[model samples]
Target: MTLFFLNILLAVIWATLWNSFTLLTLAGGFALGFAALWLARGLLAPHYFRAVPAVLALAGFFIVELVKSCILVARDCIAPRPNIHPAIVRMPLDVRSDAEIFLLANLITLTPGTLTLDVAADRSFLLIHAIYATDEAALVAELKAGMEHRVRKVFGT
Candidate 1:
């Protein structure tokens, strides 16, 4: 009964925030949103205030990385480095949640020259193709240190 009320409350919140009208449309939206929240409630844990600082920190880190990556890509494009080591590295992720892993993969893919090629069958690794890998160890460390750590911090898992 509590879950049902919670679901309805969530639905109402969504509708109120988005300002939807028409009985049919509002009902449909509420049903869909409630169902999604019900299904996803298990995966999304109850982290509240703790996430605020982490989110702010991650946002800052992302902006820095974005700027750095753009500059590097521009430099490489202007002066085609003959020794560019574009390689696919499988980064073993410790993040357990499907949503978190997807977020990380999307972030990597969105970055300048890095592409998220695949996720391993076990969901433990991300296959990423990076254009500027000087050394395997350094590249792996950069991916983990630069982004993965921040992801863990932000998502708290």
Candidate 2:
């Protein structure tokens, strides 16, 4: 949580320095601080800095998927005949730590039409409910290529 605290501190400092304590100013400051920390990775923590880009990629990917999922679900609602093949797919995991797995699960769950039901006891697999799971293999491949892959890449350092 130090990073988050540091971000807040930087925002506050920025407001104090600029003499304008608006939400937009604080947000700009936080973003500036994040950029500063990311650029100064060699002096600070390398792993955290390395994860920033991956985290950003994941965030962008998530936003895109979220929008797509929302549109899909909305189309289903509007259509006279909805054609959704819902299923619970058991997917194997290769992420190293619990935090990685948790983040992956949360990312999946946060997106529409998908829910992370549970994680295997060994942390080797996750049970996910998907609304568009027409084929298990295709869904698994998609997950592997998208969320799972990005999560592993983010924490691989």
Candidate 3:
């Protein structure tokens, strides 16, 4: 019963905020579908009140790093010195779960200048393409420090 209500409430909020569903009928349909899934699967409810603060902290950190990446890219473009140090570094991820690995890869791709190229055959490593690579150590450190750690925390690893 609680999960059903929670799903309906979530659907209503989503419909309201996005304004994609103009008619109450459509909103009710969405709520019903979501409620059915919620009831059938019995997914563990995330404690949103506890998750909100951590989410905000992660968002804030990403914003600061985004700014730094933007500035660096701009400087490299303007310097006329060919500052593009292109390199592919394989970051061996400690995170074993699929969700955590996907989160890490998505985080890498979401950042301004980096691209997640591929995962290893065993899924133990991620191939990341970076425009600036001072060294292997720097690349590894940057990935571990910049994205992976935060994702591990955010996804409750």
Q: Which candidate is the best by lDDT?
A: 2
TM for every model, in the order presented, reads 0.68, 0.85, 0.66
RMSD of 2: 2.2
Q: Assess each prediction's global lDDT (C-alpha) against the native.
A: 0.78, 0.87, 0.74
Which residue pairs clash in candidate 3? Answer: none
Give candidate 2's TM-score. 0.85
lDDT (C-alpha) at residue 140 in model 2: 86
Clash pairs, model 2 backbone = none
Q: Give residue 132's error in model 1 in angstroms.
A: 0.8
Best by the TM-score measure: 2
User: Across residues 1-157, which tens digit of lDDT does each residue of candidate 3 receive?
Assistant: 4544665677677677777666775567555656565455545565433344566677888888888888988888789695788888889987878887887788778877788999887888999999888697788887898677777666666
Compute the lDDT for candidate 3.
0.74
User: In angstroms, what RMSD does candidate 3 have relative to the true structure?
Assistant: 6.7
TM-score order of candidates, best first? 2, 1, 3
- List, residue by residue over 46-79, the lDDT tens digit for candidate 1: 4533454577787888888899988888887888
- The stretch of ten residues in a row with the least summed lDDT in candidate 2 is 43-52
Question: If ranked by lDDT, best first, what sequence of candidates would result?
Answer: 2, 1, 3
Error of 1 at 151 (Å): 1.1
Error of 1 at 82 (Å): 5.4
> Per-residue lDDT of 1-157 in model 2, one digit per residue for the tens?
4665776899899999999999999999988998888777677766665666788898899899999999999999999999899999999987859899889999999988889999999888999999899998999889889998999878863
